[model samples]
Target: MRDLDALDRRLIELLSREPRIGVLECSRRLGVARGTVQARLDRLQARGVIRGFGPDIDPAALGYTVTAFATLEIRQGRGRDVRAHLARIPEVLEMHTITGAGDMLCRIVARSNSDLQRVIDRVVDFDGIVRTSTVIALENPIPYRVLPLVTQDGKGLATPRDAARPQGEG
Candidate 1:
């Protein structure tokens, strides 16, 4: 595949904002034929520039008012082994391994503080996890944004052309 062009970068940025935008509509907005947009989208997907897309659900609206981030220090040599244990807990919405003092950062949604306690208990109950420090989300300042790629000089790269955004993003 060729290097990512301006159109490809533009497409990525647009998709990040509106993943469910239609191909035809995107072509219309970009002043290009629908086929051109489709081809670019396909290439982007094939090259792993675009992954999957889905809806963004509000945890609070779904009866979960408590949001917390859990920084977990796992027991030595058992990081990946904890997936099955963590998967059983429903309140754990997302888990990511980060570089820092902690091995994993877990995003949890709960009904209340007590519910968050339950989730934390579940996390600590796993034999593989050593310690967990949780930080409650008071307010999400930026929320989620599928960021545009940055160049070596720190300029944001655009995605393909606008296809509405792309499809299936949060």
Candidate 2:
């Protein structure tokens, strides 16, 4: 993974703000040639910097309002089975193996508090799971974001870009 130059940062900032913008529009906004914009986008995608342009869906809008985190302890050598079991449950949004008192942590969502219990039951129903603990999220003051990180200069400051030069030159 190479470092993102000034034009790359500016291009990313522009796309993050307007994901639906076409390459021509992006080139106009970024003051670069259309081919330049397309090339940069292609390179970013090829390098796996831009994962996908999928719609950002809200679970709350889909009637899954409640969110909770579950810390699970699985039986020895049952990690694969436990992971497969959790993956079959639709409520399991994401899971990670962490270094802590628990073996795995999962982010889950449900329709309500009562529905949360059912989700948790299904999560722990597998024979591979040994113990589990869960905590309900009351509020999310700061939702997920990556724009700041994307444009930062490694010193926690947004990098400045010079638009006059050709794109991807610097």
Pairs clashing within candidate 2:
none
The number of the candidate with the highest TM-score is 2
Query: Model-by-model lDDT, in order?
Result: 0.77, 0.87
Q: Model 1 over residues 1-170: C-alpha lDDT tens digits?
A: 24776566556656766778999988887778999999999988898777777777898999999999999999888977887788888888989989999999989999999988887898899789988899999987767654533211133433343234453332
Per-residue lDDT for 93 in model 1? Answer: 90
Best by lDDT: 2
> lDDT tens string, model 2, 29-63?
88999999899889989998988887888999999
RMSD to native for every prediction? 5.2, 5.8
Write down the TM-score for model 1.
0.78
Candidate 2: C-alpha lDDT: 0.87
At residue 77, what lDDT does model 1 achieve? 84
List the lowest-lDDT window of 10 residues for candidate 1. 148-157
How much is 118 displaced in model 1, in angstroms?
0.9
Summed backbone clashes in each candidate are 20, 0
